[model samples]
Target: MDVFRSMQIMVRAIELGNLSAAARELGVTQPTVSKIIAALERDLAVRLIERTTTKFTPTEAGQRFYERAKQILEEYADARADACGLSAQVAGLLRVNAPLGLGEMHLHRITQCFVRLHPKVEVELVLNDRFVDLVEEGVDLAIRLGGALPASAVARDLATSERFFVASPDYLAQHGAIEHIDDLQRHEFIRFAWLESGATVEVAGPDGSRHIALRGRYSINSALSIRQSVCDGWGIAMTPAWLVQDLLDDGTLVRILPRWQAAAQTLRLVYPSRRYQPMRARAFMDYLESEIEAVPGLTTSRPRC
Candidate 1:
């Protein structure tokens, strides 16, 4: 028998002055209440109540037990309230995981603001290109850039990343500007090795859309490395605009096809789904959503060719 439940039913029966009323309050049948009362009496080896037809009254000993049981239930409620409050409070170490380049480029700024807004939270950001098991690694949150989610992954998309065809002015000056989409084939291409099968860039013209394969002379795995290579006059590459926004503004890098771009990336805030997320993680996720919009070229529509 559930001791607490038995005690609660006895207490409610005494207060309501009727077994039927107590059963109604508890959302249980009258017979169920009678069974609990009987079990509780057997467990205590004492008759707890005097019953007559539709009315009930607690015995002297039952009065004492009822008072004590009420206190126990109140204490339990208080403890639960405290536990829920602590679970929702933002005051603990928040371990976060994210891809290297995106973390360094954008997330750090938003996190900096989030910590300032919530000083009690201590953040540990682990930046890596490889995927980490959120449960095994004990990560509160992860920001994944343009990647497929696992079968069991739970994620909230925060923003879309725009990929721009960027190259340094020096390289364009040397090789000459690409006058048309076909001109991209005549030039050596800098590729991000992680792209794998997606070496082709889909472009839209007055006629329709087609994929232009980047004939790679150089390939890099890191977004930062790819941006560096493009800036260093290695070759043209499709890079996330936020990663090279300053370069684009300063003309160190120029957007090759203003009208055309590769597919936009879906940036997601990922986490393991089991229980309610910690307050710090939830707070940071909300903060990042608002701050990410400020990144240049993130919402800017493509220009006409």
Candidate 2:
């Protein structure tokens, strides 16, 4: 068996999630893909994947191999590009993952400009609220928002987003104004469910470093859904200012406790730590950092140590 070719096939199979899909991607038949994986497993003396009739899932070893294979492939590609004097050209597919709301609101314009600047680079953006494993997902970069990131990834702060407690005028009219954090318990709150443990909203007021215990009548994982629910007067919500800045300016949404500020969230451009960062990735990050700084009220200052 050609070990390198089989390894490539195995990587494709894991990424595509099925032999048929891998076959299509590799321009081969399903049996050919299966045979390649079978040979690869035999050569490695380990079961790389667990397969059922309807689905295929990688084993822990398989996941590790997949990540390593991606790094190896990226290094090989970079070396080949350098040999061919294509390193400066920046031509290839660049995969990015970002939160759905932010991607829709900001990334599209950045992507347009990026493509215009590097005409040869093809971009694929996956927008989801879920945090994805960059290496396993084969993502080139991820745009993340919130507090401190995992130490495993290299992060660069792109912008700072202030958090605000907002509710529609209609909701406030019915529920009365929430003048204090204690009042939040009496009111129905729309919570962003994905803000998991270790996350706290720091509100400045009479009680310094006050962290409110969040209780919600309705919980959603999507920022877009949370915004819509808040706009429709479902309940008071704490969200990034950028998501509701227009509504606040237009009198559709009212900011509660404007005097008691909530901790700000930072937008970060993150990628897996590697020995070598590709020129395309570096250039894209540089462009994004520049563009994001130009936005009003958003600053790119380094976060306090």
Candidate 3:
């Protein structure tokens, strides 16, 4: 039995929760995977996995072995990379995750440019509004828009983006004008379905900061949907500047309570670990930092020495 190959197979099977998925990912047959696991169990004289009709789970010993095997695989890969001078090479599959709206507006184009620059690099861009586990999902890097992050994640602040309370010109014309922060109480507020700042918003102005309770008839989960709703003259919304900069420039959307603005949001590049970062991931981060300056409302937040 090839112990190294068995370790690799077992680790993948556990991570994916089944042998079939592991076989598909590793490009091996299901029977081959089963045989390897059986061989491993026979060699160790212990049952490594427990199976049921629904799923497969690791035994107590199997769980411990899986953890150690995963570490061994990672260390082996790192060692091989270093020995082969692969650390400096940018040829590999890179999985990236980003918020849906931001990914559609920016990261898609950014990824295109990156792949074009380094033809050997293959990128998979996953766009979603939900939280992701970087290691479990096999994501190399994630572009996060808010400050809150998982404790296990290592983040590098990418930029700071301004947020604004905005409405369409037609909406303003129909609903009248907002002169004071309290005046917002009388107008419709388009609620963004977010974990942070759900029912209330804090804005800063010359008079200082005020926390206002949001009252709205319509609530949407997507940034693009909120922008469209506000653009259609539904209500006013507090939005990240990057999402509406173009509309603002074209007069499709106008900033309300122009003197008052919400707290700036920090964009972050998040990864699973600080140790053993691949060359491709580092290259992508550097490329994004270089291009961030040209994006409106986004200012670099790189720490200065």
Q: Count residue pairs with overlapping backbones in model 2.
A: 0
For all predicted structures, in order, the TM-scores are 0.68, 0.81, 0.86
**Clashes per prediction?**
0, 0, 0
Candidate 3 lDDT, 1-305, residue by residue in tens: 89999999998898789899999999999999999999999999999999898979899889878866766776677678789987665776788999998888888998899899988889999999877988656677899988578887899888888998999989888889888888888888888776577768999998999899878888878988988998899989999999899899998998888899988888888997646666778899999888776677677755544
Better of 2 and 3 by lDDT: 3
Best candidate, lDDT-wise? Answer: 3
Structure candidate 3, residue pairs in collision: none
Mark the 10 consecutive residues where model 1 has the least summed lDDT.
296-305
Give candidate 1 regions above 4 Å deviation: 1-88, 300-305
Give the per-residue lDDT digits (tens) of candidate 1, residues 5-38: 8988987787677888999999999999999999
Q: Give the distance in Å from residue 104's predicted Cα in candidate 2 to where it truly belongs.
A: 2.2
Which ranges in model 2 have alpha carbons more than 4 Å from their true place? Answer: 147-151, 170-188, 194-202, 211-216, 294-297, 302-305
Which pairs of residues collide in model 2?
none
Give lDDT tens digits, candidate 2, residues 139-189: 889999875565668887788888878999999999898887788767778
Higher TM-score: candidate 2 or 3?
3
